[model samples]
Target: MSGTSEGQGPAGVAVPGSIRPSVTERHNFGRTASELRDYRAAFNAAQLAMAVVDHRGLVISANEALAALLGTRPTELRDRYAADLIDLASDARTWHAYREVLRGRRSRFRCTRRLKHPDGRALWAEVTVSPVPESGTVLLSVADISDRRELRARLRHLQMHDPVTRLPNRTLFFERLTAALESSPYDQGSTGRIGLCYLDLDGFKAVNDTLGHRVGDRLLAAVATRLAECADAGGPGHGGGHLVARLGGDEFAILVEDSTGTEQLADLARSVLAALQEPFDLAGQRLSVSASIGVVERAVSGTSATGLMQAADTTLYWAKEDGKSRWTLFDPERNAHRMTRQALSSMLRPAVERGEFTLEYQPLVGMADGVTRGVEALVRWNHPQFGTLTPNRFVAIAEEDGSIVQLGQWVLRTACRQARQWQLDHPDVPPLFVSVNVAVRQVWDSDLVADVAEILAETGLPAHLLQLELTESAVMGSAGRPLQALQALSDMGVHIAIDDFGTGYSNLAYLSRLPVSVLKLDGTFVRGFQDEAHANPADETIVQALVELAHRLGLTVTAECVETSGQASRLRRIGCDTGQGWLYSRAVGPDRIAEMLGAGPRPQAAAASG
Candidate 1:
């Protein structure tokens, strides 16, 4: 002691280390193991919670930090199982890892876990267990990571949930949906069904437009609460697991795992609609909101989550289209048909660009001479994949996508060029006119007058030789820009015909103002008069009245879809100037039309196929 240096302690107690000889000298002494004990001084004083446990997973010793973490004194922590301290057995993987560590199969492991405090409160701790080198004992370390873990949890919550209503968002809904499908029992052939009710608020934008968005947000929150309660209360087909999630905007969804059947899903949709029918009292404003829900339920095994969502979305559109405040179930057959239409729609623009369109002509004959006087140029899509597609299949899609203008232009140019070629080839005895159909969008969206003038001049065809025909609804009321376009085209010496006349808005008073030259009667009236058996006498009266009305208006009447000479004779008696349909010829290509032109006038067959 005289040779050693030391530091003063409480009550003049002498402490070691300052009183120690050199570390090398201390190790060289007979007390080398005691030097190792001195090395553990820092471990005891460390801020990190630490314990020394035997191979049995029992704590041999604990530091002050460890005792503080467990809300117990260091002496009390001794002899307690580490499993008992941190609730380690709560997770099977961690328990298995613990058993592996005890058996010396693994060297070390690190995990974050919830530890029980003596006060019964929970403390989150990051723990590490490592085997002591050359010793059968194990070293355990713990750190309070509650702050970081809480931050991570908060971030994850924000990411997975909608901010406005705090409902699970699209991402979380998809994740849960995938998990539900994956966990379903598919080995039994018919796995349990999963049902989804996709909801969209009807006329919600009107609320946001009339009342501010703040009120709209509150309304959404109220709606979310109602939906969550409905899910928990088990309304209709609700059999157990139900999750309500906001899919963004005014859209929300309810996912039912292991749904009973379609009847249950329908009941859920009804319950949702009924719930929303009640007016919401938001921000001192009593406002009513109703939702349209699309319900889809299918067996979990064969359907992918994305496929289910797509079907749900399509059915939602149907509900919106059918009216308001209703639920529509998934119709697989209807969905398949709509999917084909959608696929055709997507292909329309590209198909036009690739020049997959062609024209076929159907003859319109002079009723008296039975001589072909004109040809209606009908457009067909020569789709590489779908083969030849008729206008009924692709035309509406073209109009919807606004590709009709280009397609119509292509048809006009092709028809005019073909008509001019006929004149040059025949040096013919009588010139035949070419009629091209026009779309409403083509009339309004493009410079119809300019397009007609350009194609006529480029093809060197007289404007009288080409006729532009539009549907009755498109030409009924001539007003503003559309009326101006029609008048301009008519002024360019172009023949204008009203196609499918009288089917739409038969406001005859407005008809006198149009620049129409011919009234193409719809096939419905003609087919009715095809034979006396199916003919309605009222149809003949209607035809007579239409013909008399057209003649009075200075418009020639052409009866369409005449299938037999008897029907033709009836139309001629009604003073119809011309006739056209498969009764004469199904629309044929340009080369075939030329062949018919050269083969003298082929009289209508005695009983032509209707």
Candidate 2:
């Protein structure tokens, strides 16, 4: 309107047919009448929608194709803003870019836009705007891209959803999870905490294995339908609706955005468990399925998608281990303990090679004379990070990782070498036997018979002077290779003792058949023997019966944890041959054991007992 001429229509927008002649005469000076007419005909015949827009963003002229694309006549489209007709002004960014092109500040602008046709149909158009130099106008072109866009949307749906369950797939679930964690606190309502319920259908594999995948897929679809119904109630506008996704196979996850707290997640998980309890009938095949769910809820500030999922995974494993068909909440303390165990497990094999292990000897004294006769060699880890870790900390880890065999061999060799040295150091006193605990894994995973023979030969310690102690659980039920290994070791003049004697498998009949020479009573039985008034008669009677039975079978009885003189006296009266506990000394270095063996003046026993 600001630059309008006398021939222009109202508001500076030109009439449709009338504007074409002026545009040709003003911009094409050398063109003859025939050439100008030919150009006008060509523009009118073009298939793509075309519009000549003035500097005011009003349509100076619109072609028939352009009018048809907007579902209007050419005459009606003239004197109207082309952006409004094509719905380009609906988007702020696209409108600004179109304005820039109209002002000649930008060379060109192109974008995709959706438009509602007058015929009640939707249209997708690719709009392009480019300025015409010296013409004070711009060329606006649009191409109908509705079909292409529809196809693309279909492909995206397929890519981001599970076909069997008709729910979001793992990729979309991760996308949503990552977005939730990265969202601001204000964007997620009051609390920006995120929660996830990771579920795995228990016994789903059995269904797939027996009934086939067809029934399994149907079951998964039915489960998804139920979960979606639950999610709807727990979804946006309620408790912040949850997103349920099928993460491949029978594993599914429910992501809760803007979670209130653990209580909310707990309720959701319980609801899911209850929903899954009902039996499903798939194509007339009635099947019952239960699920194990791991629920984790926490603030998003310091959390990541992977970290949260890992916690959920660990908790789910705990649920399965604790017995399936249950839901378990994530526990930070338990997770930390597991992480520590993993760290210790990874360091075990390397620790042995690094020589970070040492041995401490606890005196197994004679119950009759109260003199040190033998010592039990206990292994300790001098960890650089954890400091002086007892066997309870790393032994199980080593056993699980199969590093126990290597570590066990080292203990055997070291204890034997020290026992041989003690024999040589004090020739006057009786040679002290060294008891070394052996894990069951050492027998199964390694050549125990050969390793023991080699250790004894290398250290020059007699087999009888180096006792190998196995727990009752490990020594009981011995058969095949394990039984053969024990028999071969016993045949080599070695003393075989069952440690923690009464705790496990207590198969008294199998003892005489085996080549065991000693029984080390578990400390629990000894700890019960306090002063006479506080003593447990049942414990004393059991100990006496065990000792009498061992004597009849030609086996020596060593009572462990002989803390006080009263306990030592009671154990001695029960025919126990040896006592190993604080009653003599805690596990100490070899030099201290030597002092107790009369290499120097004896340190007084703690309770003046064994």
Candidate 3:
């Protein structure tokens, strides 16, 4: 038995030279078989999905992990093809490479592939297929990567957009602008230029002050979307590709590429203005907002992003300075002038602190008797460099910067002090009132009643002798608290006159209800009386009606700009209580006012002639 034994060979035929194995060899073979079985069992329990496929692409075996991944039992997957479980639409190239590995054409193949589960959901898998030529099988290992992909997508979204407005923020805006500028030069055969429009909302601060920041934020978001729509509408077919972006709070920008010339850019600017003219509906409240656009169009060759942005910023300031809610193109000359103004306005506060301002009084007279009844206080700035600047030159800047409140208080105190001095100089003359113009900010920011009372007390002037002139719109625009403040001052015996009456859409009913003592007809209305017969009868009728209504309400009526006696007589006949203009005398200093008061009332003919 130990000598020889027949062994089965190829094709199940017995071989004569085959020798039988000894007992030691048989025991060694059994031990080796047990080790192989243990290894296969451990491989079947792996956490990752593992599968063995034959060179023909048929799955020979699958582990529990692979069966769970495919939503099937190991027995069902054992004889199935690996391709049947994968999503074919994801990528056919990856599966082809896997097949090549199974065919022994490649040693290993690794890729990310998407698979369809039995539950009809997509699963992402990082798959590695390796060939085992001797075993005629391929080993496949897979790991899930779906969560990582979603996380990366979310991170990208946050980086490119604004948190508050959900629009492309400054970083993304610059990236897009850089790409646009780069492409613009190539498209134009090396001659094309890019145009940029920068916009800042006007009166946004007022809205934030009157409403809350919540409303302001919502308003900004709404504006961003509207601007985006405008950019979309101005695409290449109609105009060109335009990109809009939010450059932080209340500021937005647009990049218009491949512009032919400034005309096209200007048209784009106008379009933006027109688009923003529509009212914004926020939190159930209708709010009106306007934007000032600064446009710069230039060739892409020499301009840097910073330079373009700076030019746009400079132009935007010009738009704001030249009266907001308008557009201004880049002009070297205009920018220089604006720079000068900016310099002056920047120096104004220090100038004020250095005592650069003075007050000038213009006399308002009674048309019938030619006597000075009051004077309108006007501000004059004796700038060290730009000397003797009037209120027209700097008042707007002061108002915008919120320095008008301090300047207004100074004017009141100065005018009251001057009036007190004038009264001391002339005891026998008629009582004179000093009318100081009040700004809307002065009313809203300060305790106006207390300020007036303090000024009068400090100057030893009677409350009735100081008239506070407020614009008609300013008076009408007051809410519950501000209106109460005005009424409180009136109750304290201070006279309140509505200045520029015809300019605003004044409600006569509300006017009568307000504690106002006088209504000054606007100069525009009085100028109409220059040609009474030729002028619109409606003007005369309106003036007459205003006068009658004022009298009925026990308010005095003062007609402004009576340049002719005919006009004076017409106003007098129309029952205008008083008139002020060149028909009497121009504004004078305290000395002239004293001399005029001492001379007494001139004759009616002489007064009219003067």
- Give the best candidate by TM-score: 2
lDDT of each residue in 148-215, candidate 2, tens digit only: 99999999999999999999999999999998898887772558788899999998999999999999
Instruction: Residues 1-610, candidate 3: write the lDDT tens digits.
Output: 3446576544344544456557896677667667877878887989989888888777888899988988879899877777766542256787677777877888888887777767888878888888765788888788888789779778977998888788888998899877766664666344478888899999899888989898999999888888877787776776535777888889999888776778877887888888789998887989888999998999887777888898999999889989999999999887777676787779777776787888767788776665667888888888877778877788878877878888888889999999998888876555689998998888778888889899899999999898989889889877777789888988988899999898997789887678999999998888788765656677789999999999999999998888898788888888997888887766666677777777864454355556
Q: How many residue pairs collide in each prediction?
A: 0, 3, 0
lDDT of 1 by residue, 123-185 (tens): 788989888887788889999887898899999999999989999998999999999888846
Q: Tell me which of candidates 2 and 3 scores higher on TM-score.
A: 2
Cα misplacement distance, residue 75 of candidate 1 (Å):
6.8
TM-score of each model, paired residue for residue: 0.83, 0.89, 0.56
Better of 2 and 3 by lDDT: 2
What are the lDDT scores of the predictions, listed in order? 0.86, 0.89, 0.82
Ranking by lDDT: 2, 1, 3
RMSD per candidate (Å) reads 6.3, 6.0, 12.9
| Candidate 3 accuracy as lDDT | 0.82
lDDT of 1 at 223: 94
